[model samples]
Target: AFVAALIAGEKAAFHEWEAAPYFEGCLPVEVMAERGPETLRHGPLKPFGLTDPHAPERKPYAVVQLRQDNKLGTLFNMVGFQTKLKHGEQLRVFRTIPGLQHAEFARLGGVHRNTFLNSPKLLDASLRLAAMPRLRFSGQITGCEGYVESAAIGLLAGRFAAAERLGEPIALPPATTAHGALLNHITGGHVDAIEAGPRSFQPMNVNFGLFPPLAEGIRRAGAARTLAKKQALSARALGDLEIWIGRHPAAAAE
Candidate 1:
């Protein structure tokens, strides 16, 4: 019912006169629903951690998470519920969720355009402009997606610029770390298409795919292989990041 309503509401949603293309990292829920019935189940609605207390044995088809929005915990924000649905349609469609039958909304969702730079082409490894080294770039504008990704890039850029000012060497984070993977992506990770029209580089969130593959002997093949690979990658990243921090005590202190 939720999936069906989302698809229906997507068709009815009011788009701006010149609606911008949606970012791949932050797609609208309705757009995900239109792809397939099970897309949402694997995406925002995936019940990865939470379980119903009353029915412990039963698995949920989907889940709607509400994040606390206020200090008092009286207001809650719907996680991953970005949309462009009309106000009436939002109310109609969202109410279909099991626990939200009488839910009062603090605000309706809306869409906005996100502008990003072609960072791979324009910036160097330290996030300095190729043409103008004095200028530095960071955040979503550098094409690294998500709040954490943006902050990580910003931190790197600040450290790099400060090192230059103090005549100190700039040491980049190891590629295995989440910060390094995202920085590498923003700097020069994307492959350019043969036919040159617009650049093919897109904003991206940090994920395991960005990390270097595990050594063949270290990796195992089985149903648990995927989980095992993630654990290995995480451990490697943590170790590498600690080494990086140790090498750059000033940056770590900051």
Candidate 2:
């Protein structure tokens, strides 16, 4: 009942779509709700195959799911809650979820115009053009999503090219590091769709899910669970990254 009221009260504003093309595939949740209140219930919030143990006799009116954002499982994204809601509004609205009453968000969801390649199908481990090794790709064009992520790819590409020119072999960065995790996604970390039509790969920013999973015994939630997990992942990434940098004398010097 509270959830329904929150959604009902929420209002979103947008510039006229006539001014710019809005891809039908990524319509905001509130926009879909405008079609009819039940539209969302039939679509993203349909309650089927799920029964709450605490209230087995009661059927839920709606449901929401979260997707793991990184390999470490430290972050998750709301399954179908993309919006134009102001940041403060988003926190208030989303925090109303049963299990997320006190949830901490690493990044709030938003929509944007993004350009990226289906890199998993096209690029090699070194970000080199598979069909034409004479050329290399970097940054957002290569499918990395954020400023930090794009800059990291550019740095890696420059290093790879310099190593080749000097007749020295440079090892790929350890997948545990932020740079390696982002690069891995560009090259082959993403699985390809079997349908063989348009690719399902989407542009993504660096997050914990991209890195290799943490060792066992670090997966439970207690007080400060989210913060502790992120700290552990960051520490591991830095350690692995330093070791990788040490392997290349030229890279280390620079």
Candidate 3:
């Protein structure tokens, strides 16, 4: 929708009006074409490559190309390829390529629907994510998800907005907490918050997996269990968050 408005030279506000159930073929439009060409070029590829065919330098029956999966040249696979199809089928279809017959895949792609509010223009600094702070969006809608991560957002939004109700200015989290990381991801972690790009603004989920490693030996690390590490971090966050909450009891209560 953003790109469409750009092409027509107008401000536009359009969203996925309706999205139904998901299937291997239905996650995104491009996923279906991998099954066959008749379904492909006429469907997802239709009129997409229709740039002056009269030119010699341009030629494509249907194009699906892969880029190096890493800085090393050991791997490559289909672009936009996401599937639950069996391994035999994947290898047979994908190996037909010139350079990737023996290519190894680190991970196959997949997709899921993520509902989110247009937060930048819609919410106050409190993370309420609405024109009115009384109504706040949370979880996948707020663009944060996970057992503890979602709660951490609530911990902040609850306390920050609660502070507002008690007539104190909203306080933001220090950038060390899981809550803070999620908040940053939603607000500004990539390009400028208002700038546009297709690859820009992918939704994020929180985990220690997302945390940048502490400089090799800069600090003594905690337990090795991934789940335990997240829990330990959560315990510490709740303590600091409670102090913030106490400052604005009413907002946290809300």
83-120 in candidate 1: lDDT tens per residue? Answer: 87778989999999998999999898876677888888
Models 1 onward score TM values of 0.85, 0.54, 0.39
Q: How close is candidate 1 to the true structure, as a TM-score?
A: 0.85
Tens digits of lDDT, candidate 3, 17-97: 634344332333334543443555554334455565588567655555556766787676555555444445455555554
Name the candidate that leads on lDDT: 1
**Residue 148 lDDT in model 2?**
83
Q: What RMSD value applies to candidate 1?
A: 3.9
lDDT (CA) per prediction: 0.85, 0.78, 0.55
Candidate that scores best on TM-score: 1
For model 2, the superposed segments whose C-alpha errors exceed 4 Å read 1-112, 193-199, 247-254
Candidate 2, 204-247: lDDT as tens digits: 78889897887855656886787888899999888778778785
Worst 10 residues of 3 by lDDT: 2-11
Better of 1 and 3 by TM-score: 1
Window of ten residues with lowest summed lDDT in model 2:
17-26
lDDT measured at residue 150 in model 3 versus the true structure, 0 to 100 = 69
